[model samples]
Target chain A: MRASSRTPLTTRLWAFGVWSVVIFFVLNLLGLIGSVVTSSFATRWLGTWFPAGFTWKWYFAAWDEFQLGDVLWVTFEVVGWVVVISGLLGVPAAYALARREFPGKRFVVLLLLLPLLVPSVTYGIPLATVLYKVGFGGSLVGVILANLVPTVPFVVLVMIPFIEQIDPRIESAARVFGANTFKVFVYVLVPILMPGVLAALLLVLVRTIAMFELTFLVAGPGSQTLVVALYYAVFAAGVRAVQSIDAMAVVYMVTTLIWLIIALRFVNPTQIVARAKRDTSH
Target chain B: MTDRGPTLTQRLRARGLDGVTLLVLPCVLAIIALFIYPFLYGLWLSFQPKDGTTMGNYDRFFREPFLYKTIWTTLKISIPVTILNLLLAVPIAFRVRLMKHQRLLTTILVLPITLGTVLVAEGMLFYFGPQGWFSRTVMALGLMDHAPSITHGYWGVFLSLLITGFPFTFLLTLSYVTGIEPALEQAAATLGAGPAARFREIFLPLLLPGLAITFCLSFVQAYSVLPSAILVGDPANTTRVISIAAYQAAFEDYDYSLASAIAMIMGAVQLVVVAAILGARTLVYRGPVAAAKG
Candidate 1:
């Protein structure tokens, strides 16, 4: 190697590796989004770098015909239940698991984490049959319950780490000062775990919004999600028949981006709890 | 009058009663009834006939080339997609660790988690269709004689997965990658190891468990893929994954037992693959002090 070429391979490696990756991301985003936007607006879909002509005909037609407004309402309904049910059930469980000294805690935690492995297809047929037998086979409530299987796990996993950061002494101090179990939980524990809970809530809500595979398999067609609707529009009536799916896609994308922004505001996302070593004196 | 707190044992007992049963039972039972029971039932249904116990479905799956092809086809599609998704995810995750403003980039990448598979499939139709963008761009640039039709088969499904599955793998791995301590790598660098050596030694060893987890999650996620399989993969040649076949059998053919059988096999395949990856991880750990210690 020429002595002059000795800019240090490590520096060269860092530049080649990290900087190139950022450029790759920029190019990819430019290509992918640039493509989607151009195609959406183009009267004639031909372009060297941009669409030949612009038109909002597809967007307007899609809005008028597809009832995207109604779909958005239902989307909120489903996501709302997903966040609320998962939060109420998941947060306390996370707290107990964090604080309690129990025999089967590790096993309990593992059991909670295991649902993620059972692929959506595995449950579709059986869940359909069982839900039918139970007569909740098609209700919005049924969808919410099925969605919770995944949502709760998500919350608990993120929450356990966050809840661990609170000192046990704070709760004991509240208890020693004439507070009860429920009162201590509400006043002390909940306040400290608020950021973590917010993280978990946003995570579940955002995920619920985009959840297609589970809802698609289990829900009736009339109860279609924006994603499922988008699929139908493209497959049943070629991409041209329903222009609204694109508008809906944009809505879905923007909603997700917003939720992601919310989640990123919290630093050290994984500290709910790690080791569970009990502080004996407290 | 001063009110005393409960006796130590009384407080402990109350905590136990309230905490264990109320907090844990519902989740446990839900999983057992919904997840575990259905798993066993599916396995039993896979083996049982509507009439009697029979290897008939299993025989049919193997004897027929079309049915057997679903297994190979599923592996072909899933394995490569899982690998590619991981490969792409690793570099980005590495960058995520090495850079400032990484949280911002991580959030942007994870934005795909907001849109479901259906939306992603729909997005692909807009982005990759003949008249969508790429083909039109090619036509405009005078690179092709006619618009290239890239949607509808292998490449279509591949591209669809490349976009959607990439994010899933990336995020799962980002959890692992960012979890790694930088001090370990810095220590290796100071000891005269190069970049590749530090990675092969310190970096890779620490991430063993995380990598295994991401790989399994990716495999399960890819295998469970249904919406995109239906929308983009042209059954003629492009894609015919096992899930697609099971969906067809249950709804199209109205053969619940056969559909159950296929699903059971598919689910088994998922568990076995995950178990295998986990096993491989254990073996990987046992093989090197670097990992066992790390």
Candidate 2:
């Protein structure tokens, strides 16, 4: 309050400096993405301020050339299964962790934390190997199982705070009315936790969509998600037109941006910091 | 009415286990089967080389300069990028926390994350390439006589890491910055402490632990730079991070054992860094600090 009404020139200068950096970073980021969008529609982009001409053929070319139809379908299938399964497994675990004082509670918390802490590539290699041994590798099931390693823990972590905010007495009241745990969960807690659940699942959806290393490690030709597919397209850069690749990049951006917008609507980014702080103390 | 024996639910409840407690089972089991088991398997697999002794895989990893140097290459890029991102994020987050348009700014910043690294790398290839807009604009403005190749090298990977890593660091740092009770700073100001003094004495101590955690998380992400390094950087040399080495071993050479070894080394290195940072975090202020209500 008083600080906001500051008279100090140094503090004002500092604020100005910080905002300048923020603006600069955001501008470059926008420009970088804009160039991709611009190039995707360009007839031919050489060394110039603008492309030689603009066109819409890149999108069609990218779709057919990359077999994007199958990729999109696979991406949706993987994200869908990951979101649903993580929610089912994570929400109840979050409830238990939030409300109960059970033995090995610390161990459970640590167990969940490890998957998040370890980089995906580290575990992804071995996980893929295991999946291969079990005959699930390079299949849709392998990708889903690999992705769930991170998402389920993520869901559990994100949902715990939401569950903690709810009153236990609500569950007790339902139980007193002869509602079993399952019934109370479905009828009482679910309604109250709907917003939190949506937020958690949406985040999981966004994360699973962008998740690269794990999916890349486990995905087969048929199981490749949009991000992995984009990687391949970019990797084999010389074979395809630059415009088409850019078009695919734009498509990936739009796909993720749409979900990100929806996810942001339900969740505050700062809450992640709160969760991080809690984990540290634990 | 005849009294019934203690029910299963009641019996389970006596041992601190109930239907609710059992809800954690599915998640825990899933993690164990998927995460813990694979990790253990990887650790075991690392020792069983294709033809040599138990330590052959790890020995081969360390024996070759190309393989062992990736650890250094990964550290070189990741450490600087992580440190730079933290440095940039803290001030911006502090500034953003005071702004009225916090959500708007945060949402804008979070765009890079959802775009994913592949898209970011692709965008970089165009925007920062030799003939891309950046060089063209710079040359047109007489900022330089020749175009600079920012892509296809270390700078490309570094820039991409900064772009993607900064938002995550900023968000975490912003939350921590905002978590500090404003009244404390106000009280400090009332007591004649200037902005610098208040931050140094009050904010920095509280922010340090959170910053350490942020550093660890951001560092881990940067440390595993696979897509961007390959897409933007000279993957065989400058940005041959440990992850790429592991990938090559596994897929390129079809050597799962060696790949698992490289992965284990990578994990070990990351764990050591994380443990050190977290260990150092404890030496700072560990007392209760109020978390501002959202």
Candidate 3:
């Protein structure tokens, strides 16, 4: 409308065409997400949409009054160990499944996928009791182990298609020329496995961070994750009755959003599938 | 690259060991121990009683009115979320093909799935919390006079589930949509079928298998939702899903056998649902013959 009296209609539509949908969804999605943070610390329920004003009381209320940091650390600790142990355990298992074959191969593959079909509670109840007898009951370590029902299966599933694409023929040729097994893995498999490994790592990290039911069921009060903490915050403290409670809710949203954006930026889903045998045919 | 001196027999043994099943040994055991063994444990425990060796736990789960209602609630929440998700997903997947910025659009759509139910629950707090924007905006717009509390009760749980689940159904359908060849659409157009007709006759048929698989995945996802339901559902409404009951029975009540029985009941329900869906799906579409290649 501004550039010329007779601007090209096709050009105008072209510029706005794709942006139309994105702008619409993005604005609304962000608006809803932002509302959580903004409302968490309002001085009053004053604005039509936003808090009439803001306050730091909720942050202090959560940070110092409620002493949320310790529970937060416990959450981090469980997820951290989960990430390290599952990645170390899952990546190699994925490699073996993807590249190696023998008797019961298909059955073994199906067995690995069986957890996805099984509900977490189906195993959680029994595992919690087993942990009790083993002396890990209600402990953070118990939560970590219990959580593997979902984490390991997820890592393995994400990693299977990725690990498959590693050509053993290269490792074979290297061995034929005198490269040892460790050298072959380090030089050949590691570089190729990096992207799949990264994608799997990020996925594992995010999932572990968000894990609630397993941790809540297995861990002591001292070991609750942020999600469990937040749940109790609302469930126990009554979030609806308070004004500053919005801030704590905001804190949850911001942390999650930051984590999600970082994960999406660095992690590649195609890497999980593309990792199977590097498209040598193409 | 390094040399190790070995006897003649050792060198021969090393070559033969290349085909050994050593690598799979631990992971296979891990799967069996964590997965297969637990279900077996649940089965065994489900049959045990507080004072006697019997199938009392299963009997109790079936007979208890509370347990029965919990099962019904799980189905209530899971089914609606599944259907609404399918409707939203199909349209988005269809549109993805025609979009120019498909990468960015898909990234935004698919990215939410990684957040899982916990994050979705937390996200909903800010989005639907009394002070959050949606409630605020809707109220300001005279949609209501005050912030409509959404996340603390039954409807809150349902909405959180919808947001979290939409992406799972969408991504699966998108992959299926992309798998369909462009030439089929061209053929339909040449045959004089309109856009809707082509989608119905060719695309929908090809997509049914993918859609069913997506629905099952989403259904299970919705069915297993514990974190969100715990955060959002009103206990008064009896929105406590089966997962919460399992936790309560095991941890709070200190009744592992009874908890295991409830878990078995949950698994049994899931299996029956799957069986019914598979039977109905196969009978209606003759699907496996068509989608076996996929």
DockQ of 2: 0.65
Q: Is the docking of candidate 1 incorrect, acceptable, medium or high quality?
A: acceptable
Q: Which ten-residue region of model 1 chain A has the weakest summed lDDT?
A: A271-280
Q: Write the per-residue lDDT of candidate 3 for residues A39-59, one digit (tens) a residue.
A: 566676654544577777767
Per-residue lDDT of candidate 1, residues A1-282 (tens digit): 687387687767766785686566545544655555555565665434555678888677776666777766777888887898788878888787777766677888888877777787777776655565577656676677778878787777777766776778998899899999889878987788887788678767767777776676667755666666666666776545433456545656666667666655753322211111122121
Clashing pairs in 3: A36-B126, A40-A246, A40-A247, A41-A247, A165-A276, A165-A277
lDDT of 1 by residue, B80-120 (tens): 99988888777777766666766556555554445556666
In angstroms, the error of model 1 at B114 is: 2.3
Provide the DockQ value for model 1: 0.40
- Over the stretch A69-157, how does candidate 2's per-residue lDDT look in tens digits? 99999999999999999999999999999988888999999999998888889999999999999999999999999999988988888
**Candidate 3 Cα misplacement greater than 4 A, ranges:** A1-29, A46-48, A239-245, A268-282, B1-21, B51-53, B110-116, B122-132, B139-153, B287-294
Weakest lDDT window of 10 consecutive positions for candidate 2 chain A: A273-282
Please report, as a value between 0 and 1, the fraction of native contacts recovered by candidate 1: 0.42
Question: If both were scored by DockQ, which would come out higher, candidate 1 or candidate 2?
Answer: 2
- For all candidates in order, the CA lDDT equals 0.69, 0.89, 0.70
Which candidate ranks first by DockQ, i.e. highest? 2
Candidate 2 off by > 4 Å: A1-6, A271-282, B1-15, B290-294
